[model samples]
Target: MAEDQLMTYAVGEQMNLMALLKNVTVRVAKNGKQYLDLTFEDRSGEITGKFWDASEADVERYQAGRVVRLTGKRETYQGSPQVKIVSLRLANADEPHEPGDFMIHAPMKTAEMEEELNQVIFEITNQVWNRIVRSLIAKHRDEFFSFPAAKRNHHAFEGGLAYHTLSILKLAHSVTSQYPNLNAPLLYAGAILHDLGKVTELSGPVSTQYTAQGNLIGHISLVDGEIVAACQELKLDVNSEDVVLLRHMVLAHHGLLEYGSPVRPRLLEAEVLHQLDELDASIMMMTNALDKTTPGNFGERLFAMDGRSFYRPSEGLTGKVDPEK
Candidate 1:
């Protein structure tokens, strides 16, 4: 019920770790190990803890996602924090709680992001592209307005899908505007439609879990199919070859097939969309990781940002005067 206090085990502190640890991960041990690997987390961030005591009762209580209380000494494993657990118990039910009590979230404004997204859709001038975009928007506007761009990796937050999609379109529209050689409509249409299926492919308000269709059909096939259907229903003369071009943007959006794209990006528009998506996503993720940093110090090592950690400059956190005052 109480706010679980963070254990500030710095680089050299004697981690009196036998304190309550919450938000831990339970991983199945590889190749028949005796114990499970538990990853515990709090707003200060996460640590890996191994629980070897394996009592049947304890196993039931500490299943993956079930919050647990723990006592352990904090230790460093290759610079990241590790916990040596001495005692463990499940968090009691009927406690005052919030989902944020466990899951981490991106530093972003969902409402503001969605509002800017509408502006991008509004900017589409092509009648055909506008028709398709508007139809997709109408079907999943609520979810698209709230869905995550991914379950993890990049842009994985509430309203993240809209934010990431809008950002990609913004960059694509801005960059291609400089290159008169590029087909503005092709690039813009591709960018706007590239990730629309993601609105339907992911679920969860606190966690961006994949939908059943995400695993079975995948976003590429889903979006491509939808584009074809929309083109047919609208009686648009979307020539088969050009539809292939639009589909290529969806299929090759990841830049390569190994990353789940069915084809590699070959066209200039496809290549640009792929790169811009990566650019926008990677920059936003790094920015999100950087924001959690404490003043005048390095941040908790971010696995999502590679092995390297971030350092927050002291003045970055300086107090500002309230203009209204």
Candidate 2:
């Protein structure tokens, strides 16, 4: 059967399937026998598999990013589904294998999200800030549109960086619209550039890991440096009032020092940006949690959201009226 259908495998059912090896780890049992702990994946999701008493040669053959044909029996472990492997081997060239099927992507289409982002960009009016923001976007447009906001947090799928930024942009626009005294240009720039560094922070959209630069500096400081470099390229004074304040907004977008922000929000716009950034992230996290839950059951605990579990109702919550009535 197809890999995507693997998640539906019932307990004790023996099956054969082709899947991507998302991860593999070699471990020793209490008896000192080597075993393979593996994660197999397709577009639907991933499942854990254990190949017990694996030979050293087999361990070397099974690695992440390889396509494998495996025989396994489905089982439940600790309330999650997994597979018990009987045997497996690398797929031959003639096998039906497609790498794209194993990758997760954002729900929104890329081009549509880009259009929304450009509309937001067009609304920015502050001359210098607009130039700096546009220059950064132009420089990293490809990565910006494709990279995940994080390896395994909010907006972790492909194109998630752009999707998360656009989400915050809409939130910022609404917040600024309600409070006219807030600076629209600064808010927009902050929303757009707040997570710009994540493009470099994360390795990529699939099987993400941190790069050395990501570990050393992080996205906040990295984006701050990007802004500085952009200002230098544009021949603008880096220490000018607008530039400094914009940097402050990016640096303080995380809202607190404990949460990764080098500084807390000081300016009113900075404070607003921090709130909007958090609001977008929190909503996405909660929504993702809900998506994984059954209609009448509780979702798994979300560590990022303070270990909260959400209840999913059987009925839709949109409050849409029935037109047929």
Candidate 3:
């Protein structure tokens, strides 16, 4: 019905792609001689096609993860959808990048999330974490307010990373309150402020993309450097045990070096922060992957994890949002 699409070949008798803005990239060759791996996503969902022949001129026209319109024939490879592209070019970025193009998720209500995060910010006893977080938020408020959580995968909406970071800290706040040995105030400060560097470490308005600093020093080290600098200005009792624990919370929040925490969680509060962060991200991602339904049992194949289709129930009332949420 749309001008962009005309009857071409089909994936099945009922399934086919009408020419639309599919994403493109220079991907590795898994089998035959390869040119570019063209990823096509439409209102229906995303699927990949092979441009077995690509010219140098075409390379100049396309970039990885860019949306593009492609004329192609559908074919199945490895029990999944694939395409053999006939022609292709970049699609308009002006078009929205919603779940139709790529999955974008915000796990909780924006206003509520911000308020809760600020609550933790107030609970912070460490002066250095307070000042640095304050400066970063003040200077980069626009970016923080508008940037997506990630370019793809996980929480990648404007305020997404902040939402996720704060949610974890909130959970940690309650859990750590039960431990008499843990300095709840210091731990709460660390949890709330740990990922503040990501405001600088990522870029973009609609989709959260990694900044050069993120690619190089990463959010952890960038945060550490910011904290270390902010500490110099505070002149807090540097020898206090709180200083040691606060630094550890930033450095070891990831829990292991392999996962990006330079140091493992050496204390109870840090360990709790690490698990809460991981769990929040995983749940947010999993929930988004399953939200939109396509058909019986299987909703659709998810691009974030290479076509792991989430199960969509055939019969039930669509779930209601949490009132407090």
Candidate 4:
């Protein structure tokens, strides 16, 4: 397909295009035949695809992270957009693009995000919290900026980990201004450090998957452990009130005990961190879904949003808010 022809695909449109195989899985059908479940992504967005009756060679050839030329038709199943794969094969070596060329990334550039984050870090006034956050961030600087915040769900694109953190940090700033009694430094530290452990939890940006530690311990606990380890290494008292409060913010950001939090928010900063985290994640998920849906139609059912489908208002009120307005 020509570059000029590529655009946000519509349902039922037949297309022959090249796309990155973002994820692939093998599953057995009701007939006991194995098939490939696939997620394909281009510059625009992602859609599910299926290749039925797969052979071993087919599986080996179509692994995730490879770019492939596929003939398919856009489809809707269970209210979500997908593709009906007619044929598929690995892209030729001579093809113009690589897998990275098709990847979706954080809206802000890495350098811009880094500079903004450094400014936020400078505002963390508590010496103990400041030291721990700086030490950990410097240790995992590259991955912390590049890794996706999740394997799937909100901010699951390249550079999403840092992007999600910055979004929450922005929210924390606004919230603290409105409620001056809230500990601004504590909330800022929590927002920046809460998901940093995802760098260890997820493998990397391409073909992202949970590591064994991620599967067993999860990012919440993994980060809590890192905070304790940092305190020990930095020669700070691990049992100090400052350390405990910061750890609680990380441990309780998930808000509820049932939602993977070891404990619920016990401090004001921790509660605010949890709320900001939830707000940013929810908005990202909704924005992603709405982007995929045409105006006046409903988008896919979001599993993260309790399997709800949100409508895109025809009035096109989806642009960024102007603070001056």
Cα RMSDs, all models:
6.5, 4.0, 7.1, 4.3
Question: Tens digit of lDDT per residue, candidate 3, span 5-109?
Answer: 222234533333333333456654656444776655443434566766566677666654455556666665653456666666555566542333443335565
lDDT of 3 at 43: 33
- Candidate 4, superposed: residue stretches over 4 Å from native: 1-7, 316-325
Q: Rate the local accuracy (lDDT) of all candidates.
A: 0.67, 0.83, 0.62, 0.89
Per-model tally of clashing residue pairs: 4, 0, 5, 0
State the lDDT of candidate 2 residue by residue for 164-214, as single tens digits: 898888888788879999999889988899999988887876567789989
Worst 10 residues of 3 by lDDT: 1-10
Question: Candidate 3's C-alpha lDDT?
Answer: 0.62
Error of 2 at 44 (Å): 2.3
- Candidate 4 per-residue lDDT over residues 1-325, each given as its tens digit: 3341223567778878888888999999999999999988877878898899999999888898998888878888876778899999888888845878888899999999999999999999999999999999999999998999998889989999999999999999999999999999999999989998899899998889999999999999999899999999999999999999999999999999899999999998899899888899999999888887778989889888899999998875768988999
* Comparing 1 and 4 on TM-score, the stronger one: 4
Largest lDDT belongs to which candidate? 4
- Prediction 3 TM-score vs. true: 0.69
Per residue, candidate 1 scores C-alpha lDDT tens digits across 216-293 of 888888888888888888887767566667778788988887778888999998899899988998787666555544
- Model 2 pairs whose backbones collide: none
| Model number with the top TM-score | 4
Q: Rank the candidates by lDDT, best first.
A: 4, 2, 1, 3
